[model samples]
Target: MREISLDRLRTLVVIADLGSFAEAARQLNLAPPTISLHVAELEARIGAPLLTRARSQVRPTAIGETLLLRARRLLADADLALDEVRRQVEGLTGRVRLGASTGAIAHLLPQALEHLRAVHPGIDVQVQVLTSQASLAGLREGTLDIGLVALPQVAGKGLEVTPWRRDPILAYVPADWQPPARVTPAWLAQRALILNDSSTQLSRVTNDWFAAAGLYPQARIELNYNDAIKSLVGAGYGATLLPQEGEAAELDRRIVRRPLRPGLWRQLGIACRQEQVERATGYVLQALARLRQ
Candidate 1:
């Protein structure tokens, strides 16, 4: 008997997921006949029928159910092995996908990416700007290799999040608009407010701060992104809240950020599946470690 092939195992896994040979073939870029032949060969090698077709729906047999679990593990292991070998030969070459929360994407990630690129030119870093929920979802679904999100993992429960940085949340006011030396709930309520939309964790936190302060923002405008909020504030629209690090440059002229009187900070960090840690992530982890220093 011939040894079962890795390709056959992968094909079976895809078919099992998609529940259609044709769909699996499309995904693998293989002809339908080729996929069918590979599955047939795999079944013959094991001396068990792995699938039964009825009215175009293919169901895995009991033995196939058992094999499916193993096949998935084998495929995952094979991929990781290949990733390791490629990294060994090329020295951090290949692509790493990362998702960043809106705040991190605008401010923190640029410096981190620049530093990483300067040190390791071979690695290709791909960044997706997403909301915190979207970023966490991407990390869990394998669509992202790593992600930077607000700490506490609001969206997904099982991520391995390491502290990247602690940014003090500051109230940003257009230069020349503030009279109060410090922010109070009453002080905040009296000001014209421009709110960052609800898509960001920061926005939600800011909203809660309002609730805690017994002040409801009379929001004059709401924007989904940081830049837009900044632009509006610069135009004298209203005050907005953001992290200190993210507003450092804006702190120079158009905007002035003051620490909330009570003082609140948000921890931002990189998140990965505990099991997906690899060479590229090691570099990211190293970068995150540097932030702590």
Candidate 2:
């Protein structure tokens, strides 16, 4: 029997997913005849019918299902191997997959990325916006190389989560409101407020600040997107509490930044596997360290 072709196996998977030979061909940009030929060749190699068509749908047979499972794994390994070799040939040393929240991505990660581009140009860092829970889960699942997460994460097996930075949270209010120089929980909680949703760590921290002051004021609105929340504050919808990450976080003319009295800060952590870091991943980590304050 001849060695199975990767291209033919891919065509089979695509056909099964799309459920039409023509659709698969269009999706794969292969001629219809080629798609048929691929299936015929695979079936010939295994000496069994791989697909059976009924009423405009193509279904894989028992043997085909078995092969499909193995084919998927093989294809993933092949892609990773190809990427590894291509990186070497293309003057790239490593690829690191990093995950963090949108707010961190907006302010904190830019500094790290800039450092990497200048100092370790050969290392490529792929950034994904994810919640702290999702980022930690991805690290544990071996899908992420690094994670910038909200602090206070429970340390898990085979993972090290350490504090990276602590940025003070500030109150963002409308410029026209003529608010005081410093914002106190008691002062801001009395007026209309927009806050991070209960899901975020920032929201919990702010809620605690209010509770400490013997106040439990409800927000006029709660949202996850920090930028959009700031926009609403700019429009005089209400005030919000958000972290002033790295340097000066300036909004527009309609909004003003005020420091929180009695001091509240959002702490961030960098997480990685317990195993020794690879060179590329190390470079990425070093870049992130530059961002620490």
Cα lDDT listed for each candidate: 0.78, 0.89
- TM-scores for every predicted model: 0.66, 0.70
Pull out the clashing pairs in model 2: none
lDDT digits (tens) for residues 114-161 of candidate 2:
988987788878889888888889999989999998888885899999
Output the number of the lDDT-best candidate. 2
lDDT of 1: 0.78
- Please name the candidate that would achieve the greatest TM-score relative to the true structure: 2
Question: How far is each candidate from the true structure, as Cα RMSD in Å?
Answer: 13.7, 12.8
